[model samples]
Target: MKQKLIFFIAIAICFSSCENKEKNQSVILKGSIQNSNDSVLIFYYSDKSDTVFLSGKNDFRFVLDLKMPVYGYFRINKKTINVFLSPGDSLELKADANRLEEITFSGIGADENKCLSQLSEERTKQEINYEEWFSLDEKQFVFKSDSAYKAQLIFLENLQHKFNNLNPFFTKTEKARIFYTYAESRIAYERSQVFSANSKQKLSPAFYSFQKEINLNDSTMVFIPEYQIFLKTYLDKKVYEQEKNYETMNDLIGAEFDIILSEIKQQQIKNYLLHSVFRDHLQFNGLEGAKDLLALYEKHTTNKKNKDEISSLVKKWQQLLPGNSAPEIALQDELGKIHSLKDFKGKYVFIDFWATWCYPCRREIPHLAKLHKEYSGKNIVFISISIDKQKEAWEQMLKIEKMPWLQLHTTPDAKLLQDYQIYSIPRFVLIDKEGKIVNAQAPAPSEKKLRDMLDMAL
Candidate 1:
């Protein structure tokens, strides 16, 4: 009897120890890759929170300490491999070591397989739609050729929606990344056709819209090499120079330049490139070469008469940089009560420049509301300035959203717009307690980025 009792106690202890060990253990991912050398595979988490690097081996095993289930992208140079994992799960994966031609993942209730299958279906649909659109005869126009541009815009919009829906389902970044490549390829193919100067005028808007769609769909982290190549090929020097519409041309040039500059690291390389492009090629010298053009303008262009005008405009652009002083503006609130920068001297101020018609601006309301609630009575002031032409829309939106922050609007004055260089909507400025600009393109208050800034400021 004594021996039996001792045996029972030992068994209980062993079971309890196993349970505790399992609770503490990390999810194990075991895999093998064939025929690859010195190639690195990087795993990017879905939240963009962390990255893991793995080397190709005959057999590879990785243990991940997961706090929760996650979707991650695996990449070998430019090629992506996507996988899904759950906490306390184990996976066994196999892949072609030579060319990354085939990958097999088994584990965690076939989550990875399900994600890949969905991605495959979406890709097939995208290919079919693209092929069908491109195959259509250019001469066949339901409306005037210029009018048909709208049809292409509609098609691109639909494509964007489809891609957005499909992207989240992809467990691997590679599969999700192919959408941008397809967009680039389609745009490049379309741009290659030589049309009469007159016909090209009609097609230009469509081409621009296509490029915009590609940019809008692109994930900030996922750098598509094909898109970069397409931009370089289609958007040449002459395209930037010959375009007369400064606003649209500036956008195109800036977007393309930003794409290129994002890849380059050395400050000298960037300054040299900017000088060659802006000063030498485009003949645009103002705010061209400086790392923070707005600041350079503010410091150098100060003549008292032009101080208010040029300083404000330069400060606006400066605010676009990460750490810059917020542009100072005195405006009246909805009740016609005047408020100035000095009033919010000792608190962190987030000034959002927006309009009622702007969809992106409106989308930020929920996020702002949540932040306001979370940081209620904190040392932060959230203010929104509307550049809307109609006060009715702004007023109506304020009422509908029940916004608690200080809401102000300016009439449609060219001077005010020019003064602030207000060329874009949904811009935000963050000001610290010292009334200095903390961030110019300070993201909307709803973003975790804003929360982080608040944490630091407070």
Candidate 2:
């Protein structure tokens, strides 16, 4: 009896200790930020649902209570510090009074010191290269020997390789180095390739190859200055003429005239291409689209006959904004019930353009479901139209998510996408009772802007 009692007590004690350990293993993130103004420190978990926000202050400290290891950002103004935190580990982030190099966690760690030393060395080398390239006199280069240009090419190549290798190990200083190196190298390469090209085809391929090599998407976050420099250099070289005086020019001019004209046409094409690429980047960053291209079109194109063509593109974009009348859509619901814009005309309607393959759109379904439940009795209709090419995937998502709103799919012809001008998904349009555009390019109802607009409209 005594042995059995002792055994039972031991078991109970072990159970209690296990429970305590489980409770104590929560992830804790603690940090201090200094000299921050209106900066929000946001931490987003990998699971994507959990997020915590901390407001910045003159001397700010915060402790985030989390359940597991996560990756998060500490944003101060426009600058951000990204870190990975594990459970039960205490992290101390100390930002400087000036908000630069304050130090993270403890004293004189070997890895930290090594990183700082390497970053310093890289920055110094990059500064030397920048001075050498930028200080070169363009007039001297006009009559210079090919040897000088060749040497510049060698220097740029070596610097570019060094920057690429150091990029993975980059601190903020190293990031600056990489940006400058890329700018100098790209400018040098563009000058050489453009001046040396024998034909229009060759020039196009060279430019395309250079763009592909730089991999613009990789540089999206930290290469803004470099990108601007590249664009300037490219445009300058694009306008360079083979002959100083076209009146006296003969063989070279005649041979290159067609090529030059073709190049001009190609430039127009490239302008649109680059604008589209930049627009995509802005969208990814959740920024308002740049109107620079529209301004350029208005400035240069003088053909009043093409007004309809231009207006169509602009109108499509306008319809994408908030409170815009949902485009006239025709699709079949889950039960093969035919629905149209007119069917839900009496009430406010949310036409959500989405697809099963879109991760963001998939993540938003639960939020939509909640909204559907909340506004079920109200004179509001939520309709999700999937543009998935495959009906199987659409049906699968509908079943898995158990979405409460009307689910519909268009035929694989993609007519609906074309009609709606939907180049991207997770887009929503809110139509008011009268069907006139209230907010075009409106975000989905899950966002605060949409909610506010809906409240007003209702």
Candidate 3:
């Protein structure tokens, strides 16, 4: 009896120690990646992220503090897996890179992960007929999709009930996420039904019966990834239909800002969506319009961190502010003839920084040609500079496309790329006749405003 009492006392002490460690910082993640020799692994919770480089054998161990019941991401190589992280959790994971869908997790945070893994695998199996379903008669499509959604919900319910004993918090949150995910899928199908029913493509009006009542304002549902996407897409579609008279993409985006400000009540999600929209579409239009949208977003958004991020982006963009002298660039033509920006002085230079592999850049060739023709004898020169490493591909495309502009192939030197700060393909820059920058990030030739700006410069 004395020995038994001593053993119990030791066990109690161990439990107490573990509890104290959890209260401090006791998240331990250890894992191995099969078929991977060495790779980088990344994981993150809401505001914190860590990257671990595996040296050999692709084994990893990470210890960090994690807030409980938060959505977290685990990225290995190029594959990403979602996880629910909780404090005091010690998770051991093993995954085969060849068969990524089949993963095994065992430890404190294992039960919920196991359930999620199985559900994903099962859903993939169940969706083997997804291609047929898309081509199915609309009536059959609705019936099958609804049945699948119901099955998913039932499976989620069973999972929550089964895992309730292991981690009630995870079960509750995961179930809610699954439900909202189905809701998002259902809405997407309903929206598609409207399109598919053009002249009655076999879907009865009853196909949309499920969407008659939906809780768009479910604050908690916003946490679901699908709902996050659906909400933004739905808002964009709505704004597109409502704001019929908008001129530029940025103008439509500014109206989207106004719509979100007035309609979206939840400050966090509202600001997040608004900032995302503004940052993406604002620069495609004029700089003054972008500045106006920035001011509008700054005035309305309540997220201070988002405001700071926008401020940083604005500061970065201001590096190409108009009136800044164009960066000095020395590029070579197809025949090994070197040319500098000084050669184009006293002529308005409409420059395209592109690569042979860039599809969008190729698509703009004809438009750039038309602009070149439209502004002939106007003291403006169209300069096409390729960032292609191979001159052969550049020469082949230039021959095939029969581009009339002054085509040059060049590697991106550091100072030129840095001064322009062009991150995306098919970037256009407008230099005034005085050798000063007019619009460092000018509109594309496809955009009518580019012609307007060119005419103004002429």
Pick the winner on lDDT between candidates 1 and 2.
1
Residue 425 of model 2 has an lDDT of: 72
Order by lDDT, highest first: 3, 1, 2
**After superposing candidate 1, which stretches have Cα over 4 Å from the reference?**
1-325, 414-419
Model 3 alpha-carbon miss at residue 326, Å: 3.5
**Residue 163 of model 3: what lDDT?**
72
- What local lDDT score does residue 409 receive in model 2, on the 0 to 100 scale? 91
lDDT, each prediction: 0.57, 0.54, 0.73
Clashing pairs in 3: none
Write candidate 2's Cα lDDT for 96-194 as tens digits.
Answer: 536555455532122333344344344444443433443344433222323333444454455546544322323332343354445445466446544
Measured on C-alpha atoms, candidate 3 has an lDDT of 0.73
Most lDDT-accurate candidate: 3
* lDDT (10s digit) by residue, model 1, range 146-247: 343443344444544544433333323443245445445545445544322333423445444444544432433223343344445544533444544555
**Candidate 2 runs further than 4 Å off:** 1-293, 300-311, 318-326, 411-413
lDDT for residue 339 in candidate 2, whole number 0-100: 87
Better of 2 and 3 by lDDT: 3
- Leading candidate by TM-score: 3
lDDT of 3 by residue, 124-226 (tens): 6665253455556666776777687778778877876777665766666555555555555555554554456443464466765655544556555545575
